[model samples]
Target: MAKCDACGTTILFGGKRMGDQRYCNDTCAGQGVLLNRVRQIPDGDVVAFANQVHSGNCPKCSGQGPVDVRDSYQVWSAILFTRWKSTPHILCRRCGVKAQAGDLAISAVAGWWGFPWGLLMTPVQVGRNIWSMAVAHNPNQPSDALLRQARLILAQRSLQDGRSQG
Candidate 1:
């Protein structure tokens, strides 16, 4: 027997589950995702960034968003044994194209530079990143809550950039 996670109702039949989920219907599944996204946000800088986003300013560059939501996807193949991550921060319009380019560049360097492993891992990992970037979508007139999520991401990148520079 499964129980609806959202409403806590006992699910006698017609229940559904996806990735450790138990739900009575589609509506509950949607609610579960929203709640999960909120819960996944960690503390510390994200809290600070969320506050900043709720206000008028951008938490990242403070450059004001119309901001792009960058989604970085990582793939590791134990057989081919290559790990790659690529990031491209741009205006919402160009983010997709830039992400694709960055992924290809990173994958190629990791693969060819590494020789055998690069040849094996580069193709699949590059393909995965390309697909993800192609599907990436940033909402129009992003809500404050969504901006807060983006803020957390961008702030982390900024810190990384600073560390790498100095």
Candidate 2:
């Protein structure tokens, strides 16, 4: 039996056979994949907009905010999915806004829609619409096209709002 070179544990599953294989189980292998995927997405910034129940521009919405959420198994699954999906959200300690892995996934799609200059608009726009639905006690089914439109509109409005503020 081939041994896991790092931990010296006996590897139960057959090694990739391509030569040097290290991890003993799928867990370690998956960890490597997760790390790589995270590196592909931008870090340290998040998208946010007005929520239906809370549109008063509270401290969380004032002058931008920093936020982060757990990218666990369930959340990641929601984000990678292509159609309408919902998942629990995590909030930033500083900002009261909530977002899930799926939320981040939508943002990635909107942000990189184009080359040279990816629009910073998809996730926030979709989030706003979803929030509205949440407040109205309606179940908002997220779609690819609708999400795209929401992102575009949010990007434009955000730019306009910024310019007006300047």
Candidate 3:
């Protein structure tokens, strides 16, 4: 059985095949293509690309100084099930701060009810969000994650162009 190139899930039935990679769905296929393209980009060029992306308007609010931020939260239910969620956003400092604050509140309120993992992970996730907020001292500078996101965006655009032409 072929495994999905993007998520490593086993392909139990028919799947999309691109070159040597197989994907279970269109989303996985798109992700796989973007990952492949990102791998091909040189590390030296990523920062430059990120700077270019930072200069553009935020996808969320059309504001300047857009940066890519991912905030995670945990939720526990029935003492046995734990859910960890990470949300990604491309926004200016004001919007990112608001989103992070909301996720942090949710995690703090509802993330510590399960057995061992919920207890352990809730603090970690909360701390990570706090640290992210504290360290964002400059709104104008693009973060490392923003750099990676920029690379992915470039790859996606290239892939789209290739698809349109082919």
| Range of the 10 consecutive residues with the lowest summed lDDT in candidate 3 | 69-78
Alpha-carbon lDDT, every model? 0.58, 0.38, 0.77
Q: Please give the TM-score that candidate 1 achieves against the real structure.
A: 0.37
Give the poorly placed runs of model 1, Cα more than 4 Å off. 1-65, 72-83, 86-91, 113-116, 141-166
RMSD of 1: 12.2
Whole-model alpha-carbon lDDT for candidate 1:
0.58
Clashing pairs in 3: none
Residues 22-89, candidate 3: write the lDDT tens digits. Answer: 99999999888789998887766777887776777777888766555555444544487777777767
Error of 3 at 85 (Å): 2.6
Residue range 1-166, candidate 2, lDDT tens digits: 7775435677787743223446666665544344333344332111222231122222444533222221211111133332333432222322323443345455555444533233324454455445533432112232232233334445555555767999
Top-TM-score structure, candidate number: 3
Give per-residue CA lDDT, model 1, range 55-139, as digits (tens): 4343344544454445544333344455655544434435445656666666655555444666656786677667756764544
List runs of model 2 lying over 4 Å from the truth. Answer: 1-20, 36-64, 69-90, 94-166
Q: How should the candidates be ordered by TM-score, best one leading?
A: 3, 1, 2
